[model samples]
Each structure stands twice: as structure tokens, then as C-alpha cells.
Target chain A: MAEMRREWIVNAVLAMALLIVPLVALWINEPFYVTLATRVAILALAGVGLNLALGLGGMVSFGHAAYFGLGGYVAGIMAHHAFTGLPMWIGVTGSNQMLWIWLWAALLSGFLALIIGALSLRTSGIFFIMITLAFAQMIFYFTLSWPAYGGEDGLPIFVRNQFPGLNTMRPWDMFILSYGVLMLALVFFAMLRAARFGAALMAIRQNPDRAAAVGISPFGVKLAAFVLSGMITGLAGAMMADLTRFVSPAMIAWQMSGELIVIIILGGVGRLFGPVAGAAILVAFEVIFGGITEHWQFFLGLILLGVVLFARGGLIGLLAGRARHG
Target chain B: MSVALFAEQLLNGVQFGLMLFLMAAGLTLVFGVMGLINLAHGSLYMIGAFVCAAAAAAFGSFWLGLIAGLAAAAAAGALIELTVIRRLYDRDHLDQVLATFALILILSEGVRMIFGPFPLYLSVPDLLRGTVDLGITRYSLYRLALIGIGIAVAIGLWLLIAKTRLGIQIRAGESDREMIAALGVNIRWLYTVVFALGAALAGMAGALVGAIQSVQVGMGEPVLILAFVVIVIGGIGSIKGAMVGALLVGVIDTMGRFLLPRIFAAFLDPAQAMGVGAALASMLIYLLMALVLILRPRGLFPAHG
Candidate 1:
């Protein structure tokens, strides 16, 4: 119990640091730092979504970028139509309401995940990795050639979308909105992990055959987890689009998917606060290394290789101690 | 399409397929023998292209550049295997993926740093520069030569694998690594040799393809994705499957791009059809992969122990 408390304290301190660092920047008149913090929150949320599948469910999807991109496109397409005073479908005019946008993003991404997960879950291991990647590539090519939106050029929102009770155009307000969503996601993730479903998901991950022997359907559990994972990631994607006020095929690129995986591994897979720490570290590295050299990626690669080889547990593991499972 | 254009496209598809085969063959071999997912395999391809480009420019001979590229790639592959990859053999797939992915970032940026951001071009050799008059149409002599080279390599590989002691050891290692190691074969050296051989094939593909496309940093990523799709459709660790899957993907991709727009034009207004058809055509190979997976979860030609 004492150890658990310490871990919670660590989580609290990590989340508080995320909130405080940006607020301090706001106090000192550095709005750019606030935006960067918002990016961390949004990216962390995406990482959390992936961790549910990869860390808990043991489905290493190399195509979550498809969901992320889809969510971004949903936001972008909606905002585009709204700005142009056009209806999207059957007199449903586009609106910049964040709530409506999130709902649609979740619904669409959930649907896409259902279709994709049903097919992808049929295969396992390396085949699963390749299939997910191929599916993402399918979405990527489709977007690259689609002329209606911006195609390869991507679509941009001139102004940030309005959030209820917040003027999201302000950098601070945007940061708060993203940070709040991330908090909500973390709470939900905690609840899910404690739930019976989460146990079933983890069971499937450890041993699918054994899980089946215990009266659990591994496929159904994994599929549910995958869909839920995609939905959360889609919401993060929507927020990301809002943060940048732009959506492009780059969001769905395999590289983006890889980054999300990196985030999970960097923090500690299956740990609740993993994504938060991972996101903070990644953004810090990007800011610091990027400021120093153009070849930061080369160094980032070395760091990542060292982490994978020498440090099985990531930032969370290093700071909070090894995850129970780890 | 006219008969001549159809024949020309058919030939083009085969040529493209053969290029993909070179990549897929090596990838499958590594996967089968090592059980490692080396994402940096594509980076080796980029290295090959860069080396070939620089060598050709310096020596004024494509042939010499090709040999240099192959040798350099093999050496790089072996060096990395000794330094990094040897440690990863017993690790999980995620570790392998991340480590290799890191290798890609380092290699790509390293090459970019040295070569500068601008793309370098490789000119075709004089002997293989012009067109060959086919009965239906004129085709690039270089492309025909590439096809010829690909076929010769494939045959040579078959012979090497079927007729050599090393090939027997490789087969044994794949089926029963512990037993083979117990038999006193130097497993470490065998792994290095297989890795280098695979790297050499990727180099050959890169050097050959460089003459057609500009040699550039990050040139290998798209081809890498396509090769993944090929290997998936072919079966993860099967050579015969790679060859068949490559041809299927190549031909389907080419034919879809060529015919889908026309087919859509007949159904929808021309402009809309063009846009929609192009979008779908671009995704044809992935769609085929999805279909194949739905039907054969283990791939069409899954290799057995």
C-alpha cells in the first residue's frame, strides 16, 4: 500500500509538472511554450490510447495513425465546411463546436476500428504488424490522391474551434482544454484498468490460449479493446487537429504510428502514467535537441536504441520503479 | 487499351515485380533465418544507392559502382550485425522493431548529413541506355537489363540455396536452431553471413533502381512499405511466396492504375471518375493484401519447419 501510494504521488507530480510548466511559461509571457505543452498533452493522450492495445491487450498495431489521421480529417473536413457555409451531408451544416466534433470523431473512428480490427485480429504476431501497417498505407494513399479536401497539401483551419466555456483561440485556453481532456482520459484509463474487462484483456495478452481456457473469448476482448483504443486515439487526433488548426496525410503516416509506440516504450508500457512521462520527455528532447542541431533525430535514435537495449522500463520505470508486471 | 500498350504495361509490371522480388527475397531470408524484424533494412537500400551514385560519379562506370555498392552494403550489414543486431536475437519483437527503427533514423540522418539534403542522380550505363524494339513497343534497354539481372540472381540464389553446405546449415538453423548449434556449426558466423547476403541483395536492388530514380535520402521508405506488403502476401518467411506475391502486387498495382480511371469514367462523370479512380487505384495493392489476409491468415505460402 505504501508503494502504491508512492507510485500515485509520482503520477500526481508528473501530471502537475505538465500543468505547471506551461502555466509558468504563461506567467512569463512565453506563449510558445504553452502551445508546446498542449502538444505534449495531446500526444500523451494518443499514446495512452495505443498503450491500451499494445501494453495491455498486446496488440502492437502499426496503424493507429490511421485512426489519428481519420479523426484529424473529421475535424478538418467539418471545420472546412463550416467556414465555407456549406452542409456536410443532408443539411447537417459543419459546426466548430468541439463537443459535436469529438462525438463524430469518436463514432467514425470507432466504426473504422471495428472494421479494421475485425480483420486484423484474425492474424497474430508479425502478420498483425504488417497488416495494420498495410491498412494505414491504404488510408494514406487514399488521402494522398483524394482531391476534395486538400489531398497531399492538407486542409487548414483559419481559427481555432470554439470550446464550451472557453475561448480556445487563446494559447492558454487551448492548453487547459487539452490538459483537461488528457486528465479525463487518464481517469478513464484507470477505471478501465480496474474493471473486469481490463483483466480479461491482460489475460489475453499474457496467454490467449490460457485465457480461452478460463472462459474468456480472446478475440472479442481484444476487438473491444482495439475499438476503444481507436476511439480514444481519435479524440486525441481531433484535439491535435484543433491544436494545429490543420490536418494532413502526415498524421496517418507510419512514422507517426512509430512515434506513438516510442512514447509508450519510453515511459513504461502498461503503466498508467507512462504516456504522460513519455510525452513530456519526447517534447523536451525535441525542444532541447532541436535547438542544438539539425541532426537531432540521429541522436534520438541512439537514445532510443539505448533505452530498448539497456533500459527495459522507461521513464516511469526509472523514476517510479518497475511496473508490477514488468 | 491497344494490344501494344497492354503488352508494354505487362512487361513493365514484370520488370517492377522483379525489382520488388530482390528486396522481398532478402527480407524474407532475414526474417526466416534470424526471426528479427529489421526496419533498417530499407536504410541499407538507401546506403546502396548513395554508395553506387558516389562511386559511379567518381569512377565514370556504373558497373564498378554497382559492385562497390553491394560490397559496402554487405560490410555495413555485417558490422551492424556484430555491433548491434547480435544482441537482439533473443529479445522480443518489439525490441527488435524499436532498435531497428532507431537504426533507420540514425542511418537516414547520417546519410543526409554527409550527402546533403539534395538528391543525387545516377546516369544509366551507355550500354543499357537506349530502347529495345519489341514487337509491340519500344522498352528501355536498361529496364530489360534489370529484368535480366533479377532473373539471373534469382536462379543463382536458387542454386546457392539448393546446392551448398551453407544453405543446408541455414535450413537446419531455421528449423532447429538449438540442434544445429549443438552440431558445432558457428551459429554466429552463419547469422552474419546470411545477414550480409540479404544486405547485398538489397544493395543490388537499390543500385539498379537508382539509375531510374534520383538517389536520395529516405528513398527506401516507400519501397520498404511495398516490400512489406509483398512479403505479407507472399508469406513471412517463404522465398517462393515472395516471388509470387511480388508479381501479383506489381501487376495488380500497374493494371489498376492504368484501367481503374477508364472504368470509373464509364460509370461516373469523367472528372469525378478520374479523382475517385485514382484514389482507389493507389490503394489497390493494399486492398489485395487485405483480401489475401482475410482468406489466408497465415499468408498464401506459409513456410513450415
Candidate 2:
């Protein structure tokens, strides 16, 4: 009975935090914050993607930004080609449509993840970390040197990719769309965690040899988790590019990858809606600190240091206290 | 590309690889000895470059600047190892990664505060500024000198590890920590000294490269990535492997940048060809690494029994 109340209160708190505040802000016409909230929401969705792998599966990937950038590029490129009358490729119809672009982004990142994960998963521990990082760096350098899109300067989407009926140019509309995606991602995350595959992933994360002995192919499970994780992150990236209307090589940079990891650490590793809280904290810290000081990165660094050293189990973990039973 | 250009690129690649080796050697050693995955290794590289630049400007001598940079890097390494890193020695990789990432932030922002946003240039000595004419090709004499210095350092490290008593302790520490501590070997001092030595090597690499490139705020970042690649390729924790890995990566990267575009130009328009080809070629080494890892998860040369 007490457990029921605890769960109810937690859900209520999360719903109020995620939905109520944003809706109130919208009604109040404080749309400036709505835009920022959307930024946090989309990035949080991306964090959810990573949390599935890193948090639940104990896979520390340093290359998820490659998928993120690939997703962004997919959005930007399809839009650019549609605008400029350039075909995506020969013997196939191109799409500048947001939904279709997202579909492609998801598929492309999933495929890339299959390759990266396949190669990287051969080595465990630090080797896995380094290999992922190296592959991401390769992609980053390629994006920087390749001038077809924009090279180091990044490409801007002059108009948001068309989303059927929505007027995405309006701030509130974009925020609503981002909010919708965040809900979908959260639901997907919850459903995924409840699945048998999720159980296998958790089992493998706990002990790979044990999982393998129990007839779960640790390799396949990990690879599948990694690919799904990439696809989710890719979806977020596709939306983010359109949100900011810009895509650059920096999207795939190692620092961006590290930032995602940082965000996950800030929230809580495997908790539901943890990314939402983490993104909120990170973006809020950025907004407030950035407004006050030009060199807010110094302060952000200090805060990050404090959290890493002192916070222990992140916001959710601190608040919830190990969820009573793992 | 001309033969001279090919040779020159090869030389440039070697130079890059050696620098990577210097950075990776320390990182791999730390990993091997302590099981610590440090992200602040890059910050140490930045610290090295910053100190080199500052000291060079103040002292008006490149050699003195190099020495000062080495001193600063070593001191920073020793201090951090003694205070925070020592505590983390027994912790897991995740904690170490987080702490080191934090250190990178602190060091980067601290340096930026001290030395504004503007890049500080490290001028090569007038004595080593000229080009060496290799009959078919001419390259910077300073770069060739760098290669020579790198080789000497590699040999010096080899001797220090193979013949010296310190090497035995480092090896023992890698194998077993508690046993060594029980041996009354002053294990703490050994760890500190090894860390400081690693920092000095990284600093020397930074100081040397400072002459060729503009020493900027975030200059150490790219080199940090390359060093990671080197260590990954050259089997983590092996000094000899690091030397070999550095040269291979350096040459391949340089050659790819110089030649791949021309090769693609043969097939496509010059503009698109150069853009696509150069990008793909830059990624080739990483692709190679991926393939290697798939085949041999422990890298080309694993360093354990």
C-alpha cells in the first residue's frame, strides 16, 4: 500500500514537472521559455536513447553523437535537396518531409550502430570505449572536411521541414511537437524496459558470462540494444536540427557525445523520465548561468564536478533512493 | 601527386604519429598500471602546450620554453595523482572517467581564464627553421629534427623500462598492487614518478608540435584524439607498440589527405572529388582500426602475460 502511494506521488510529480509547467508557460505567453523547454525535451529524448544502452545495459558508448549527427544530416540534406531540386539518389524518390526524413534518419543511424556496435562489442571494457570514440572521431573529421553540406560552418534549414499540417515555424507549435515526441519516446522506453529483450539486456549487463550460459546471446542482445539506442537518439537529432534549423559537423563531435553522457549522469542512469529531469537541470543551468556570465562554461564545469563528486546516483537516484528494490 | 609530395606527406605522418605516441604512452601506462581510464589526459596535453607557449614568450627561447612546459606538465601530473587520482585508484572506470572529464573542464577553463582566447604562436628556432632537401623533395628541417628527437625518446624509454629498476615495479604494479605494497617498495612514490614521467613525455610532444602549429586554447584536443587512436592501434600498455602505432597512423593519415583527393579527381570533378575523397580517406584509419578490433580485440600487441 505504501509502495502504491510512493509510485503514485512519483508519477504525479513527474507529470506535473514535465507537462503542467510547460502548459502553464504556454498559456502565460512566456514562449521564450517554451523554446528552451523544447530544446531540453528533444535533448532529453536523445538522452533516453543513450540511457537505454548505458544506464540499463552498462554499455558506455562514446559514439552515439555519430548517430545524432547522421540523423541531423539526414533531415538537413533531404530538405536541402528538396529545396534545390537535387535528387537524394538515382532511381528513387527523395523526401524533404519531416516524418519520412525521421524514418530515414532512424534507419540510417540504426544501420551505423549495427556496424559500430558489431566492431566495438568484440572488446569489452576500455577497449569498447576507445573504439567507439575513434569511430566517432572519424565521422567528425569526415563531416568537417566534407564541403558538400557545409564543412566546418554547418548548414541551416531556412524553413523547418514540413510536418503535414503543423505550422512548425511558430515557437509553441514546435514545442508541442517536441513534447509529443518526448512522450512517445518515454512510452517506448517504458515498454522496452518491460520486454523480454530488455530483461536479457539487463541480465547481460549484470553478468555477460551468466547471461550467455542462460541461453541469451549477450553479443546479439547488446548489438540490438545499441542499434535501437542509436535510432532513438537519431530521432532526437533529426528534430533538433529542425528545431534550431541548423546542422553542423559539431553535431558528431566527441564533446557532444560526452555532453550526452554528462546529461545522463546528471539525471539518473536507468530511471524512467530521468533524461527529462537531467535535460531540464542542464538546460536550466545553462540558461540561468549563461544570462548572468559570458563564461558560464566555467561555472557549468564546476557544477558538473560537484555532481560527479558529490551527487553519487544523480537526481532521480538521490530523490528516490535506489527505488526500494532494484 | 609527385614523389616528393608523397615522401613529404609520409614524413608529416611520421611526425604526427610520434606525437601521438608520446601522449598515448602515458595514457596506456596509467591504464595498464592503475586500471584508470583518464579523460583528462587531453587536458594534460593542453596544459603542456599552454605552459610551453607562456614560457616561450616570457623567456624568449624555445628550448627553455620546452623545459618549462615539461616541468609544468610533470608537476601537474604528480599533484593530481597525489591528491584526487590517488583516491580514485581503487574506484571503477566510470568514476575515473567522470573525475577526469571534470578535470578537463577545470583545466581547460582555467587555462582559458589565464591565457585569453587568442592563440599564442611558438616560433621555431632560427637554427632549425629551414627545409631539408631530400633530392626529390624538400621538407621542414624542424620536422625532421622532431622525428630524430622522437626516435631518441623512444630509445630512451626503452632503456629506462628494460634496464632500470623502476620498470620492474611498474610491471609488478600492473600484475599485482597489494603484493607490491606489501613488499615495502614505496608504491605511492613509484606511481607518482611514473605519472610525472608520462606527463613530461606528453609535454615534450606538445612543445615540439607548438612550433609547427599555432598554440591555441583547444589545440590539444585533436592531438588527444590521435593519441587515443595510436594507443588503441598499438596495443594499450606497450611502449614499443605505441612507437609502431604512431608512425603507421601518421603516415597513413598524411598520405590519405594528400593522395586520396587526387585519386578521386581522376574519376569525379575536382571540387566534389576532393571534398568526398578527402573526407573518406581521413576516416580510413579508423575503419582500419575497427577491422583490426573485430579480428583482434586486444589490439596488434597486447602487453600482458
Badly placed stretches (over 4 Å) of model 2 are A1-8, A91-93, A323-326
Isolated chain B TM-score per model: 0.98, 0.97
The residue-by-residue lDDT of candidate 2 on A1-326, one tens digit each, is 65436544664586567666667888998877778888988999999999998888888888889999999999998888877787767955556688999999999999999989988888878877788888989989888998878989999888888787889988877888888898888888888888998889999988899999989999999999999999999999999999999999989998888888888888877777678778888888888988987677777777777777667667777666654313
Interface RMSD of each: 0.8, 1.4
Docking class of 1: high
Worst 10 residues of 2 chain B by lDDT: B90-99
Provide TM-scores for the models: 0.98, 0.96
TM-score of structure candidate 2: 0.96
Structure candidate 1, residue pairs in collision: none
Worst 10 residues of 1 chain A by lDDT: A317-326
Per-candidate RMSD, Å = 1.1, 1.8
